[model samples]
Target chain A: MTQSVAMTINGRRREDHVEPRLLLVHYLREVAGLTGTHIACDTSQCGACTVLIDGEAVKSCSVFTVQANGRQVTTIEGLAEDGVLHPVQQAFWNEHGLQCGFCTPGFIMAAAYLLKQNPSPTDEEIERGLEGNLCRCTGYENIRKAVRSASQAMNGTAAEPSAQLVGSAAAPVED
Target chain B: MITAPFEYARPGSVDETQSLLNKYGSDAKVIAGGQSLIPLMRLRLSQPTALIDIQGIPGLNEVRRDNGSVEIGALVRHVDIQRNAMLRESLPILVEMSNDVGDNQVRNLGTIGGVIAHGDAAGDYNAAALMLDAEIITNKRRHQARDFYRDIFTTALEHDEVVTAVRFPVSTGRFAYTKFRRRLYDWAIAGVAVQETGSSWRVGYVNLATTPRRGSAVEAALAGGASAADAAAQSGSDIDPTSDVRATAEYKRHLTQVLTVRTLQKATMAA
Candidate 1:
């Protein structure tokens, strides 16, 4: 029950024979071997498996790999170019946005998509835009700050995020 | 959670899609955005033997005006409807309803035709379609909004019938949709949709019964010169709603009245 699927992932074409039932999250993590996309919930309630399909944010776990055939996908791993962090990735780093880091990829991808559509989003717009991504730690205060910072960077208005903003990680790594 | 194994088909045409439906019969399911069906499949609530992906079908995603109505192809995603300037100008209620559908990701990939075809009682589009008096166009023929929905999660679409588009008469009056949910992205416990046509109001309720309910009694009351509160007070009398995890039957009935009033007032204000 496997079909040949060919699509561009992380700006590179990837082809594989996969099951029709294989979720896109598994395709990105297993077949494509990009593990930054985490799967926290199989029910699609959690946004941990979010990614960009044709430049729009979507829940990869809810999308079948076969459904994404011949489409372009951008995972969290695809955000950075060469050795430099994407503005979103750097904002999360400098703003102490990651709590456990398990949900970091999903948050970053959602925020990136948000900024793509609204480069100068208001706080309410940011809250509404990123409401799909949940953060059990940081109470989403720092995550909201990170998205604001990223918006400023994407809009080319802000200098480097202040070093003082990176006071402490939101939550300790469980491992 | 992985879905049960199923054969897949990407039909390029409506005839091909219907033929695939005929080939697979009742065992096959046609998927548009896969927003609702995919989650159900992953949870094993729906396990079709074959999935016919209709995203590749040609000319099934256009949103254009025809005659005096706006025709929306089945593959028109929520975001598409939400962002279309023409639709925004002509049918802002639809845009408002689409905006309230789900979070950003859901709206991006979820199709208008898919949700309408799903016929979920709590789905926002059903109430919109009901209030708008939309025409559900399928491969076979057009089904009137009042005749399209059979029950909760049921529609007039046969196993092999493919919904091609929906036609909504161009609206030229105030419209509003209000949903009451536990969270921003959750399904509505009870929702209200109000649309004005000429001198009368067309009202509909979501999740208040097995099918999306029209506020016939409320519409009658409004037509009889009743105030918004008085019209909305008749809301609970027109439909039946059951208790669920979201709320008690009494609470849903209460919400039905309150949301109906709020939507009517908002719609009036917009007028």
Candidate 2:
């Protein structure tokens, strides 16, 4: 009743025997032990379970594990390189985009895909792009600011390191 | 909620997929994007004994123009249709419809063929295919979009047939698709699509009935030079709206006319 699946998650090859009905989110959380991809909503309505499948942001909860065979998945844990943070993750810290931080990982991953699609999204475009994810804490203003700041950082227009130093996340932030 | 256990197979060719379908018959479900099917399976709303995963099938994901038709492969995902430069140029309204489908995550995994095959009334592309006079091409034959729907979540597709592609005639006129949703991303409570094909007009209604309904009377009135508001008033001629959790029956009819007028006005403005 189980299917063998081979996929690359966060740059590591993983092979597992999973049920045909086992969702990718369950496999990522229970089997792979990468729990950063939260399941805020089991239904695909919320993007809290979003991850990159072959560089496209998709709701992991809706995707079956066997469907991801031979594909590369990038979760929230994959955002950092060695000891440095991804620009979007750094921007979240700089902008204080989280309160309880439960939805932060999903927001960062969704924003990463947003920036990849539109590196310099306008304020309105950012809202439209991230409509899939919801932050129940009403931290949308900070989330929007974080995404905008991430766009600047990724596009190399971020404020000087002194301003970035104000953030708790340390610098030489890039790998 | 977890889905009931089922046997799964990924077939690489349409012929092989058809064979699997023949074996499984009504017990097997062909899964492409799995956006709708997976959700249904998880809720146990539908429990098929077998699943023929057709994602591995090749050649059903390309969008091309051939012999006066814009042929979109069935496996073409919504996001790709929304972003396809060729489609954006030749069949822009289809692209616009895809943009309004669901959230980005849903669009990433949902395929056009799956949506057309699933045949949800509230789905945007259903109305688009009808309004644009697209053809639903299957492994066996071609079907006019006008005769595609049977009822709610029902279509003209046979149990063993697979939708290989949809061919749309190149649009030569302006269009406006107006839909009203309760939430920012909810399914359309009521929607109206008006397309002016240069020589004639086509109007299709969404969620106004058991299936995607064509505003034939409204189109007729418009062709006879009726004003947009007057033509939109004819939208309710054939549709007997039903009350659902989204809106009251009267409210849905009201929205149909209101959105019809809005879409017609928008299309006129574009003209």
lDDT of 1 by residue, B52-92 (tens): 99999989999998677999999999989988998987777
Question: What does the lDDT read for residue A40 in candidate 2?
Answer: 83
Model 1 compared with the native: what TM-score?
0.96
Docking quality tier of candidate 2? medium
* Model 2 chain A lowest lDDT segment of ten: A166-175
Q: How high is the TM-score of chain A in each model?
A: 0.90, 0.93
Alpha carbon lDDT at B10, candidate 2? 91
- Output the lDDT of residue B183, model 2: 56
Task: Enumerate residue pairs that collide in model 2.
Answer: none
Q: Write the per-residue lDDT of candidate 1 for residues A52-149, one digit (tens) a residue.
A: 99999999988999999999999988887764577888788878788788889999999999999989999999988987777767558888999998
The list of candidate 1 runs beyond 4 A from truth reads A160-175
- Candidate 2 local lDDT, A74-156, one digit each (tens): 99989888656788888888789988888888888989999999999999899889888888898999999989988887777
Q: What's the CA RMSD for each of the models? A: 2.8, 2.2
